[model samples]
Target: MFLPDVHAEPDTEVLFQFIKENPLGLLITGINSTSVDFLQCTHAPFVLDLPNAGDNTTPRLRAHVAKQNPQVKAMIETLDTKPSETITLDQEVLVLFNGRHDHYVTPKFYTETKPDTGKVVPTWNYSAVQIYGKLSLYYDSKTPETGAFLGKQMHDLSEQCERSVMGFTGDGDRPQPWKVSDAPERYVELLQRNVVGIEIEIRKVEGKFKMSQEMRPGDREGVVKGVSRALTQVGVTCMGIHLYVPRQ
Candidate 1:
């Protein structure tokens, strides 16, 4: 939650694009203020309802969790307090998405600038985005509105994951993307009974990319080489990666 200005990214479209690439998010909820379960975190892959590049409308996040998941209970309880005249901060939830290209920087990587001062230390280089929002839950596909909402979420989420994560094009020579309609209506209905749909009206979003850019050019190159060499040994490619400290 602490974001330093030098590390902060003011361009939201860039941040949203990062989420589109890395759609799995860690959902955070602070439920009962005085209870042990106050801080709740859940991990799930979500599809974003991002608006056009220049639109002023707020974006949203859509995902579903198992009906029996403990986090569901927490979210349901939070939504129940909307009638209160004074809205509390606990009602807002956070979804954190981290970029894929991240690595650790060791003092050893400071080949060019180190060995002179012997003052370098180890730090992590990573990129992350935090999104805060008020979430609404849909319990079932029983009503017209609820049915449409649940159905669209399932279908769209499936297609998006297929196209984005699975590399299915749903056209051309690539493999065809799958959709919720691929299954029997009754089967889909049966599955829906065991889960709850979640929609978050995003209130705020912030991205931090801490990649050791603050260091000298020589040190930055050293980090890239160190990470790339380490990853190459493990059959991974980590050529260029950057992350930032928290902002002001």
Candidate 2:
């Protein structure tokens, strides 16, 4: 991920919060040094669980993918392979969550502060988190244990979104939050059969907040104002973006 020390975010809370806000993570597998053809990727929604987080516990991510997904087959192959003298059955994968709006900044944005410098170039501003974990695939989604797990995953993910900026909550004017049980039981059961559950025991996590933290103070504010005006023109609010200002 090429995370520099200057832009690195080492806080566990911040990483977890980013995953919660951006649950639709990209699951990447089959990262072999030999060939790129073996690589696989799947876009899936996830539920972050940090049960023992206070004690420096590693987080567990829960999500489900269609049974017919090619990535599912690749992971199962890893599980079925027996460890020999040089091989092991363990499969590690990456899940990437892109959490915020990314916009391009032009040199013109910094021209006011550095009129003759000509130092600023085009760059992008964004926030993202990368999670690396060992894959644990559950094939029996219909069993009581797996079914319960899937149910909880569905509930937690939907409820979290209900309370998010793009979602609705039953306040005075908004409609009530929706639930998984709102669907017909028979239909839900049929739908469940086509998917398999995935649980990731996270081994490591990294966060990158590239919000012009390295730029000069005046140039930083100028870039922010330029992007804000552009976003507002398109009816998009920019209140939630966290700004990074140098400490005095």
Candidate 3:
């Protein structure tokens, strides 16, 4: 969260795209100031309500998980407390979405650069986003409206998943792939009974892209090339933002 000006990502679109690409996130909240706990869940990308088209206001995140998950019980207990006059929801909760990262930048990549010439060193590069917000929790079957909302949320996520997987299939005589609707009434009932939905009303969003942006152009280019050729998983990490080289 301590993002320096050099690494700050002010572009909301870029931050949102990063979150969409990496949906699994950690939801963190506190029962009191000292009792902070984390809940991990996979989020479904939803439209973030913005006051204006270009506003930098934090965007809301939507996600759901099974009722059996311990996090659900912990959250419900936290919500039961009476609202305090001093601390509002805006100051309480935080969600973190981490993307692909690696540790392959070697000092050799920057040791022969122009600006530093012979004094530069190596550093790891990565991307991540942190969102601070209010939370709204919904349990299905608690009320008619909430039940319907849960059903709709599940249906929407199902469609999103299907689109991601089915779009690649070439035309053939094969039957359409399985959809959420294909499930029997009992299965739907079971899902409805077991699922809990969470809505995070974001107040602040912070993005960090530590992709050698601070290094001299020559040093950065060398790091990128070296990382690209490395056989470790870090190769893909460098390759992804290779085109997003630092601005002079």
Candidate 4:
């Protein structure tokens, strides 16, 4: 995450939009002690609780993981020392969301398009966001609260994904989107036993958008058209080709 000042993206709106579009984030956890090299990483779909633009409240990431996951066991082990603490707020973790589209840029694209510009070189165009926060695990291995918490995560996650694609219409003619409540109550109860809920309260978020903004004017436009054409050929919708130039 070595973000140069030129590459840094401070736009909060763009950052959240990127996260919503790419909800599947990689979660990395490390122990509190400096001597420990133990690190746990998991990939899960996260639902963001992003407050209003001017609001000062911290954002949170909500998601769940399988109960059998080793990271779950690792967190439980780490929290054993503080039995009274239901939520482990002291442990910071990292969550990463990769951009939806990324492509390599060849100097040939620039050289051929702009024959006079020999200054162009190869580069990569991509977008990425890194979130740092304290992870709060919400499952008491022995209590009913565990099932309830896990169930809520499942329900919310399902609805989020469904709504993004196509929400339930309640019409008999069209096939209804699947929901957590659609499953049998007993089956859901049993299903919840196999997973646990987690939430990360975000302390910091950073976005890096490298889309040839630093290149010469001719070279920059060449990249956009070249990348767009290449993406269309492969049947992929181009996501972000950021060309925002920061004021000097």
Best by TM-score: 1
Better of 1 and 4 by lDDT: 1
Work out candidate 2's RMSD over C-alphas: 4.2
Candidate 1: which stretches are off by over 4 Å?
A: 33-36, 53-56, 77-90, 239-248
RMSD (CA, angstroms), candidate 3: 5.1
- Residue range 1-248, candidate 3, lDDT tens digits: 87887888998788877776666677765553223345334343442334467787656776667766665556554554432111124335777888765445888877447445567555777789988788776675556655776677777666555555345233475345456688897888777777766667777788988877787777777777777778445334443647346544
Q: Candidate 3: give the clashing pairs.
A: none
- Model 3's TM-score against the true structure: 0.76
Model 2 stretches astray by more than 4 angstroms: 31-37, 53-57, 81-89, 165-167
**Can you list the residue pairs that collide in candidate 2?**
none
Off by over 4 Å in 4: 32-37, 52-56, 81-85, 111-114, 141-145, 166-175, 235-248
Q: Ten residues in a row with the worst lDDT in model 3?
A: 82-91
**1 or 3: which has the higher lDDT?**
1
Tell me the spans in candidate 3 whose CA falls farther than 4 Å from its real position: 32-58, 81-91, 114-117, 165-178, 232-241
- Between prediction 2 and prediction 3, the one with superior TM-score is 2
Root-mean-square deviation of each candidate, in angstroms? 4.2, 4.2, 5.1, 3.6
Worst 10 residues of 2 by lDDT: 80-89
Local error of candidate 2 at residue 48 (angstroms): 0.7
Residue 209 CA error for candidate 3 (Å)?
0.9
